[model samples]
Target: MAFQEETLNLQMKYFVLVKPSNSTPSCILSLSTIDNRDIYNNLCQTVHVYRSSPIHDSDSSFDIFHVLKEALSKALCYYYPLAGKLVESADDGKRRVHCNPNAENYGVPFLEATANCTLSSLHYLDNNDLEIAKYLVFDPQDKSYPLVFKVTKFLCGGFTIGMGVLHAVCDGFGASQFLKSIVELSRGRTEPSVIPVWERERLVGSITKQPFPKSPMNNVAFSPFLNETSSTVIKKYCFKVEGEMIRRLKMSLRKENENLGFTTFEALAGFVWRSRARALKLNNNGETMLSVLVGMRRNLKDFEPLPKGYYGNSCVDANLVLKVSELNERPLYEIVKLIKETKNVGSTSEYVKNSIDTWETNGKESLKMKSGGAVTVLTEWRHLGFLNENVEFGGNEVVNVVPAPCNLFASVDMSIFTSSNKFDDENDPSMKGGVNLFTSLPVDAMPRFKEEIESLRFLS
Candidate 1:
């Protein structure tokens, strides 16, 4: 009760500090929780997502602050862990993973630092400025997501919501749950048009139950051969990619061959693998490997869906191996076809088992090596976020989405998030979707990278 009072004071101070001015980036979200001592090590994952689409229909009316206030009030009513520092059995029956926050692998005692994931939507006179569409608050000054979201107000009146999500318990999906929950609370309608489910063990089972392997040799996640750079930089650029371009490449795949039979992701992922390989000059390279994350939820489709508001790493990796020259030499369609064949409907048990086998496998998996060819990874977080808009506040809705790339599992050299957005929403043409790209290279690489992107001839 006392902490609640303190939280209120913090909110008021923050609100006064971030008061809206014509130029200042305004505050759109603010809330706090008792800093759970066992948070960081206990947390399962941390991710920030953004969604934007042009507002098509008009109803230039909203009670943005009133809606957001109600939403936060409800989120505060339910105190939950951001990340579940877990300890459990390897076998099935929906058990927690055997983990120790203090253990070497897990690094026990999840941190309790308050975190935040801020989502601010800046308005433009025209849609030409898509590049600077959504500026997310990454690398928070608080060093956490929840802390950044201490105050909430809709900026530019009603078009966007800034969110600072805590990382200790939820991943992006969990954040969506909070959003949806708030939406329901604001409507004075407790019957969540869709309710959140939070049974962790049932969501993402133990690694022991479903293993995915991580090798040493080809994996770029941990290798000494990285270009001379800081560890922090390495972590960030671990996997830098262009989502819209990827979509374009994938759409090309579909247009080229109707029966090629592969998800756009599978097709273009191969192309990206080849592109990175070519860029890095690793063609015809020796044992080239890429691993893709597979969510066990669909694999276990026979079972009930994982609980809503579930925040755990619910997926594992699939090994994609190829000779770099062989991959590069083949037509894009052929490479994608191969990717399709490699697909497997894996489950938690399979993921846990494969991880054990792969960790024991002869080489490094997550490590990105100058010696190895390019690697391609996949994630369904973006795909799943399609429903985020279902959770809304007043007239505001989450329509488009972007996922932040963070150091995950200490294995992947390149972590890819499939940013999903629906462009046809006529009512909210105000939203435009684009990927929020993060890289591990020095800040200097950004200028050059931008130059390269600008220099690219899309027509050519």
Candidate 2:
């Protein structure tokens, strides 16, 4: 299929300040204990792209911009913190949400624009052309609003909604919940099904009187942003791994070792880790590490499952270290075992509680420390309800959803597995039920990495 590259002529229609319809009290909201403040300190934005179905002339009266603005106002009433601005705290010098109920700083910035090109014309675009995607959303460094949105109307009567939310306010899950509420309201729902909870203090309680021992994990420094020179060339690649291929890979691993039982995430992550290790060609003595974000909402034993409305950073980082030589020589099952074991440790409530306690005791100094060695970070975004929402902008359901790469954590190599859409053919290489891997690597290493990934299909 020939893909056309068309210029999108976007003209700003108007800037709307979406405030909560109901009044809210003024206050400052602090980061939760589990919130990795140091890592997300940069002014990076998480962009979500949604493509809408074609709008017919019969529905010309349906004004998408007005509907979104009204629904957003209602949604902000429930998720007021998002509507607030991020201001640095006087005492700690850390940024916190200043949630004032008045209209001044409490409204989110919403931009409505019209584009000359249709959404279909941009189907050829992918992660490699992220600039196009970035242009669809608000400025990443724009700190005026914690959440900003841009709706672009296409000439073909289709539209796209791009949302840019600061990483400091909430994680992807929290952001998705907030977006879902807006969609529900847009659909004429009286009330949002899931309310938002803002009790971050409960997650990260006050410090204890006695000094706690420093955690071993704090020994390494934590550098989330990479020092980029003019010569540094970072490129992103998106690859789709079908469910059949994933199942076969896991089956092969279990066949090699009868005791192995790895989930799709573990198996795929291990495959990517091993491939990268080989591509980088690290020395036998050198270490290769895999870091993953583990959610603690349902796993916390001390507290009941976090309320449906609970919206905060309720996750911790887990790592697996292995010698490069061992990683290359061992069977895939062994690597899967290592990943499974490491993730299991962080799966428990006790583990998450202890991690928070350690962070509280160590304070900012420990948080500033970067990891000792280079590690590859993998963030899984599957089943986060990005496409499941009933998002209608005067048309049918969302046709395509693309999550832009998070540039904040640009220090180490990063890979994100976003959800995929369905294709017609079951055996089609681009079939649905697959995961789209958005990855970044040095220009020199990417060729070898791509080769390694392509060889997965031949796995026996």
Candidate 3:
């Protein structure tokens, strides 16, 4: 939690503006309504870790900074919007990318930094403490740029690449695609495997003309505390849920009722949601909500598919509302089935279009979550290609991929990641085929929360 005994003594070496290698059209790109959410106004940071390579010690010919900077420039040729900065419209006050044709004005910030200690001394950055981890990423007060990159080299030849991209520009999947492109270019590829597409207009379907009903998203508050200045302190904990436990849970559910198919996500999310409610000991009369961020790429393919390389904020949060007593009373299978059904209904083309139309008609305020009630938001990142793709820079082995910590809402938020190559060891049975869950909850309830999760798994 304290970063370590040895001080990082990290110092900034230099900051350079990396522009696109080839000229791209200069125009103001209007972000889709889905991308204009107020919650996505800030940067979403992710740090990519790489261990020491032979090139770091013996090969003077290979320079990490030089290779990555050049690759970034080439990647920018395809992802030019990232080189541009976000600007507000004069009329609607909505944010949009302003691509300055002048190469001098539009460029992504590439920062170089150095740490006095080795990455292993920092435990390969497996900790969830933001106070220590924030140093590795670049998060500035002015978040106008669509993208920013920072590479910090350690004394032992290891390094971490910190990427900060505006969430409105893309979702986790889209960002992963951009990262793959950079990795490809850095590895001496002339072109990326997937071409980039920028057609935000396609997300804007026909506006809804019918009278809108009360949406469940309105009741799904992300935080129980309304004021950020409250004295409540929330802490984050990362737990590895073994594949055996997940399989057993699913098997138990099937034994009860074999009619429905249970996914790992549905089973785990249901368990965590129920576990949190029980741990918190919420009043039975009160309501609890579960919101899951569902990727709409496959759903859109059913009706008017987006381009192959189309990467934007193509995700919608599906909400499930239930009374606190009902959540505790219902069996795990019922909860899992409910979650599956919610996802099934939300993943349709009609639902996506209707969501878009609602946002377009009523604006972001319509989707704004109200304060009060217990809410837990779950998002699955295993299949997002961050671990599956070749995101390696200059053949460096990726050690870890982590979301940089930020001050978010007071409610519980869970990010699930499957076993990565870093932990995929044939000898280490405990580390294989399992999912790592990153959970943030109030510091007071964390002990009980862990107990509840363990009890559920063991009882199942």
Best by lDDT: 3
Cα lDDT tens digits, model 2, 373-399, are 246788888767776645444355564
Off by over 4 Å in 2: 1-6, 42-57, 124-129, 140-144, 205-230, 367-373, 392-394, 423-430
Index of the highest-TM-score prediction: 3
How many angstroms is residue 145 displaced in model 3 relative to the true structure, after the best TM-score fit? Answer: 0.8
Q: What lDDT does the true structure give each of the candidates?
A: 0.40, 0.69, 0.75
lDDT of 1 by residue, 1-460 (tens): 0112211111222231121111212112111111111222221233222232234124344434444554554443442222112232234211222222232332111111111222332322112222222222223333322323322222223233445444434455556666666567677865444444444334322224323432433533222223445342322432223444545565667677777767646754675555555444453545566666666445353455655444444444566677766766777788787766656534445444454344333122323334322454555455555445556444445544433333342333444544434432333332234333332333333344344333322412
Residue 107 of model 1 has an lDDT of 15
**lDDT-sorted candidate list, best first:** 3, 2, 1
Q: Which ten residues in a row have the lowest lDDT in candidate 1?
A: 1-10
- Give the per-residue lDDT of model 3 (tens digit) for 1-460: 1233247777785567899999878988999888887767778777788888876577767677888898999999999999998988878767899898595658888888888899888867765454456678776555798888889889878889988888888778788899999889887789999998989988764557762454553333233332355465666676667667677777888987899797888988988888777765666776778888877777454668778898888877777888877888988789999999999877887777777787777764565554343777888788877765488666567877776665432234544554543744533475566777777667666788778766646755
Number of backbone-clashing residue pairs for each candidate, in the order shown:
94, 6, 0
Model 3: residue 104 alpha-carbon error in angstroms = 5.2
What's the residue-level lDDT of 40 in candidate 3?
A: 76
Q: Candidate 1: count the clashes.
A: 94
**TM-score, per-candidate, Cα-based:** 0.57, 0.87, 0.91
